[model samples]
Target: MEKIAPVRLSVLGHPQRLAVFRLLMRRFPDRIPATELAQALNVKPNTLSNYVSALMQVGLLTQERIGTSLRYGIDMQSARETFDYLLLDCCRGRPELCAPTSNFDLNNKASKKYNVLFLCTGNSARSIFAEAILRQEAGDRFNAYSAGTTPRAGLNPFALEVLQQKGHDISVLRAKNVSEFQAESAPQFDFVFTVCNQAANEDCPAWAGQPVSAHWGMPDPVKAEGTDAQKSLAFQQTYGALRNRIRVFASLPLGSLDRISLQSTLDDIGQLENGVSA
Candidate 1:
């Protein structure tokens, strides 16, 4: 732990390297393509390659080829170990110092209600599932909204089916254009999340409120292939994935968390691999 922790810290010591790591953390579980990562960091491809290599050498990042381009994602196992080392070994019995502190001024009205917006490319499946799940699970605590970058003609039938099976009211669910929420008349969002890779990568509309944003990208169940039962199973899995995430989000002590800590928690939530884990 001692050796690995210091090495990880040294690699992240460089400003550009740290920025790269932070961006990956915010987009956890969604591997960003090489070109997109470079553009997002405003770093040259060659330089970014070296930075990525440094992180990979220390086991802080993982790389894979999705088609023709290389994609990068955080190595969650390494990250957890590094964090555990810091909290367990460095705290010297003063664990309170490591705990997240409250910043009441950031979200002072968390005790009341929070408006959350979930986004995706089609708004027909993943985003719809997220909206419905949060509404059903935490309706009193959060107002759930969803929209698409380029909405489809209607909601995905399988999504509606799964929601109906789960006893959710599907009457209010529809594929909405993101512009609807960007309008001056829309409610001020406290949290904005992109639930699919396409929406997360796209240039999104500017929200009126300075909402905390994160990428919680998941596989699109709508694109599932095979028999009808298989396709329906995909939708059910998507619903389960969103439900697990929403439940964890709803259970957070929002009233006590600072903005930074809240952001971290949201990012960690994104690291959930599927419908499993906290």
Candidate 2:
């Protein structure tokens, strides 16, 4: 029997490296200043310089200097190819396996479209963004919705602005509690992602069907403060992170693999970014 090796994208152990990589991958084609990244992660300049140097050394990041400022970004095309290599083993010289691996029924599933629910505690920033991000990112793939276990009175306005800046029309977004989707009355869900630390630890709504659940806890961007520019920057930052993950999710192979293999693919999709990690 031939055993297939699992995909490996970024070096996974250190949370700091993951943070920097996630930031870099969050916005492709647009360079983020190293100074800004250091501030965002609450690290020192010298320490962040070392991280950038290491990532560039490993071909996971690229840096350019303009005057006194240094900007860093992923070489998105190559970065995504690196991730594709891990999953499809294409760079290992097997082009055949790299082709689309289908598992889901897109045509016949008109009657059975998968639903996804994103849960958080506040329903203000992170969960709201995830709902918009997934809808815009995977519009045809799944029906994505968001609700907080402890719902806020209204959706975060910054979240709305972030979605608008990303070119998504989200006039229909609103905040509601998780009681809206309880087991006895909830719509069946195929996946559930909890995006807040509070909600992940709380007793969650009992999903009607067994959904593939996970957590992608992000710091509350709204909780961050400063000038309007500073707060807006925070929303843009968090929006970029969630958007990257959802992009990877939308590109997944959907027609050829068995259900078990497809589930593995979905799990990997969340862990791996569509670009370089460092």
Output the TM-score of candidate 1. Answer: 0.69
Per-residue lDDT over 1-278 for candidate 2, one digit per residue giving the tens place of the 0 to 100 score: 01212211344235777677766553433467878788867899999988777667656678889999999987655565666656555347665566444333433344545788888887877888888888877777778889987788987787887788888777778887888877466676777877755565454434554565665666789788999889999888888878877776667655455556766555454444422143
Tens digits of per-residue lDDT for model 1 on 1-278?
Answer: 78889999999999999888877876776788999888877789999999999999999999999789999999999998988888888886466889555332445764577889999999999999999999999999899999999999999988888989999999999899999998889988888999987677554555664687888878889889999999999999888888998898989988788777998888888888785674
How far off is model 2, as Cα RMSD?
A: 10.9
Best by TM-score: 1
Name every residue pair that clashes in candidate 1: none
Residue 40, candidate 1: how far off, in angstroms? 10
By lDDT, the best candidate is: 1
